[model samples]
Target: MKKFYIKTFGCQMNVNDSEKMAGILRSLGYEKTDLPEEADLIIVNTCSVRAKPDNKAYSFIGNLKKIKKEKPETIIAVGGCVPQKEKESILRFKHVDLVFGTFNFMKIGELIKRAKKERVVEILNSKIPEEDKVPLIDSYLENPYVAYVTVQRGCNRFCSYCIVPFTRGRERSVKPELVLKEVKRLAERGVKEVHLLGQNVDFYNYEGIDLADLLYMVSEVEGIERIRFTTSHPCGFNRKIVEAMKNIEKVCPYVHLPPQSGSTKILERMNRGYTREEYTEKVMMLKEEIPKVALSGDFIVGFPGETTKDFEETLSLVETCVFDQGFVFEYSPRPFTKASNFKDDVPKEEKNRRLQELQNLLRVQAEEKNKKRLGCIEEVLVEGKSPKGKELSGRTKDNKLVVFDGSEELVGKFVEIEITETSPFFLKGKLLQKVKV
Candidate 1:
């Protein structure tokens, strides 16, 4: 069988894209290979979200140059954001055989066929594929408990500091019935949890149904113990979603609603389409609905034109919201984004200082929040052995990672553990005397 390797970077959307690619390749009689060196094809599903991951992608591609030398017949393909963003430049690299974009993902095999004959093939601007057009893959690395179900593709929100709208294109959602069918199929295959993925998750609307209705439907499936969605935009989170989360027993008590900046002026410049007051109201209402819900957020520290006052407003929101976790980054210009057109005058040193300060304070808040979990019993979906194999790692309903010792047979089962210690990143636990169904 032909062997292939796919290395994915970026958000859950990219993960879902890679899975679709794997499925497509498998349908072509290809087998997934762990070692890139042993593969007939290598695919780097890239991300261009921030500067670091973009740099990482380039470095990875540079290394693959050697692999191409060792295996002259092996084809190297680049897909996703970086390829979509730098289509022509990517082809300049002698090692890159094909370049495809987010919309052109389904055309990978076609592009490879062309590359074999033409020596270079790039399909970065093909029309976006319909949701049902992509093949469903029997997973190469199947997890018993968790699956990422993508109900939608792309984004329309042109956040000034974001490149998603340009690279991922307009929002197009899959029908709710299709999503439920996929969830049911996953359940039949032993998946106990499904994390719905989208760039703007709450914006999912197919025909008349929205994300709230979708969550409610997925909750009804047998064998699905939990449901979660991520990368929610504050503007799209309506009361319906909040109420649905409260009423649905299977929806996890965890939300990652990103309030990029708390300052009204910065929000305006970012085209986030929501005010600080509006964001606060949504968070307050959700907390009222799901009292035990743990909140996480995304923050950008040094957006162009941000002042000290703007930075203070962000810090103030962090204090008021008390986020359990956050992904904080310094603003970096991306091609084709509105913000990239503005002067990037924020000093590098200042940006670094602001990001570090915000990170330090959040670490303190996270540690304090986690401390409260100590001595409490929480149910965990045992993932697998920790890196050392002496400990086991799993996640709680609040989406916190917990590690403890247990029998290897318990790896895929849900077990209750008594928390014994806490760290900013994870909770340490011991096997509880009782197990629940």
Candidate 2:
């Protein structure tokens, strides 16, 4: 009858980790609660990928101090990237009873019990142990029809501006059999969509099976209607993967490749192995191989030594790629990143200006591309009701959001929709027919 509450920060990986922790708690007879104040145990899953998220995590934990004070017996735990990197530093918040690392969530049940008697701080070393490689089959799914399966962990490519390699450690892929087993189980449980996740997903290679082979294997799952992977490094992404996407019927035609910067000079400084030209080649390859591919990318507006010319090349790349979606961020130095040592010469004002300009360009491109989809029939996987509640919302195979009027029965089914209206962000559609999966 004990209740637990979790506040998750950062990307899909963090969300999946939180779900795994929740599953472990459930197995221990703990029910999840929405409000932290009402829970007997409170967990703050943190992220330190960027300064904004890092600061937000600390701020959230600070707020939880009051609940800990009001309920003296309440246990407060902090885990994820922040704890992985900061280690005991996170325990500076006296209210925090436990501090665990990125790979330590699998042991949450024991950690929670230990924290009850005394403060516990366990940060696993960089290398992921063999036992930790096993996929969490009991992970609680937020959406019954969709789930995130992490096939790989950590990053080997230590980009100058990135802190993932330090926080997540070296790249370690889950056994292909384990991944397939998890996917099959999820499919059996009514999951129609599985997003294969990793810090560098395209780098996934277990034994002899690569991401391409895994995609073909996942497609064989009877009830899995869609397979998508994310956060691919351009250097690791190859034609074989593109071919798998093209040949596999179940694989969605959406790839989130972060090209960091478009200028060769800035790219070199960032330690991103691929050049602007090489990055463009890969983008072109994806478009040529799969004409319907919807490309989303990440861009850092200003780095330590970025010049005006460097920023222009990035703008040029955005124009050339015409990304379906773009996540543009103003660069902030993070601890332990190589770029943090370099002089952050780009003024904050300049970083802001460049970010806005790049974002505007991406927005314009997205609007133009979305407008082209008007009147076209798209296959959409009905997720749930839209924010307005009157219409149902879902996503097309290419990952474009589509909203239309539909019954609740259509929540987990695939439907054909005729795009009636479009915007830079989403598409309004008319339900044409239910897809017989």
Candidate 3:
């Protein structure tokens, strides 16, 4: 049996992709290994969402040359966005035995078989293969309470700042029946939570079944205490989905809908397809439908032609929306993206200043939001003991982290915690009695 090791970086979708790859390799009699140095085959599942991740992938690939010197037979393969984007450059490295793209996962077994004979193989195909053979590997979830259930593969939105459209290819949804089957299997395996993964998750509409129906269907599955999905496009977030979040018992009230920018001008430039007013309306609708819902969002500061006023509009939206938590990032130009053709005009100092301001503003709001939970008893799925065993760390239904003193036996179970203390980042809780749902 060939021993292989795989390392994945970036979004949950990429993590699921890595799982599928591992499953494929396992079906081919390849056993997974933790140490890359000891493995006969090593795969680096790359991500290009941010410059830091791409830089890390490059650095890791460069370091592999040293490993190759010691173990010449070790097949070093690169896959995902980095391989899909930097096709020929990855081949420049002598140690890289294989380069495969995201869509070419079905061909992994064949690629490895060929690499043993040819020493070098690149399979970055333009079209996604028809086969939807999911991997059958033992899942390596960081927490047993939550498991990512991937319902779709890829994106259709060509947002100027995004590389997802290129790397993930066009939107191709999984069969709804198949998704239900996977969820059922996961339930049987003792998984309690299912977070549906996708780039534009709400856009999942196939064979008369929309994401709403899927949500309702998944909620019916036993053992799943909570269900959540992420990276929802504003254009795709409709009234039906908002209503589903409220009606579906297992569907958590937290939504990760990326508005990208608050300025309509910047949104238009980014090809985000929705205006600030439209995005705001979506938020309003969700709030009206699910009043208790805690909102989370993403923001990119300093796009190609972003101005101070444009940035202030963002701050204003954040103020108006009062998002529970937002992941703010300074715009980093990605190669081959539409925005890359525009002037990288946003000064680094200005970008940093805007990012800091956004962070500071959000910090204040987050602190206030957390304070609301001070006396409330929140349902938290105990993940595990924190780095400081002084408290256990778990996420509330709204996805807020609550650290409390709890028995290790309660790790995978859901327990109600009374929020006693709060911070902008986390809440200190007292494990109130565990209640049966």
Best prediction by lDDT: 2
lDDT of 2 by residue, 321-375 (tens): 8799999999999889999899989999999999999999999999999999999
TM-score of 3: 0.93
lDDT of each: 0.86, 0.91, 0.84
Off by over 4 Å in 1: 124-126, 387-389, 433-437
Model 3: C-alpha RMSD to truth?
Answer: 2.2
Q: lDDT, candidate 3, residue 322?
A: 82
Angstrom error at residue 146, model 3:
1.8
- Best candidate according to TM-score: 2
Candidates in order, TM-scores: namely 0.96, 0.97, 0.93
Candidate 3: tens digits of C-alpha lDDT, residues 89-155? 6778778888888877656778888888776556555646532564434555556567887787777
lDDT score, candidate 1? 0.86
Write the number of the candidate with greater TM-score, choosing between 1 and 2.
2
What global local distance difference test value does model 2 have?
A: 0.91
Residue range 1-437, candidate 1, lDDT tens digits? 99999999999888877887887888889998889999999999999999888889888888999999989899999888987877765777788888888877777777878877666555546566777765555544445568899888788888888888778888989888788888998898788889998899999998889999999899999989989998788989889998888899899989999999989999999999999889998999988888889999999988999999999999999888888999899999988788888988889999999999999888999999999998999999888887667898989988999999888788777898999999998999999843543
Model 3 ranges with Cα > 4 A deviation:
1-3, 25-34, 131-140, 387-391
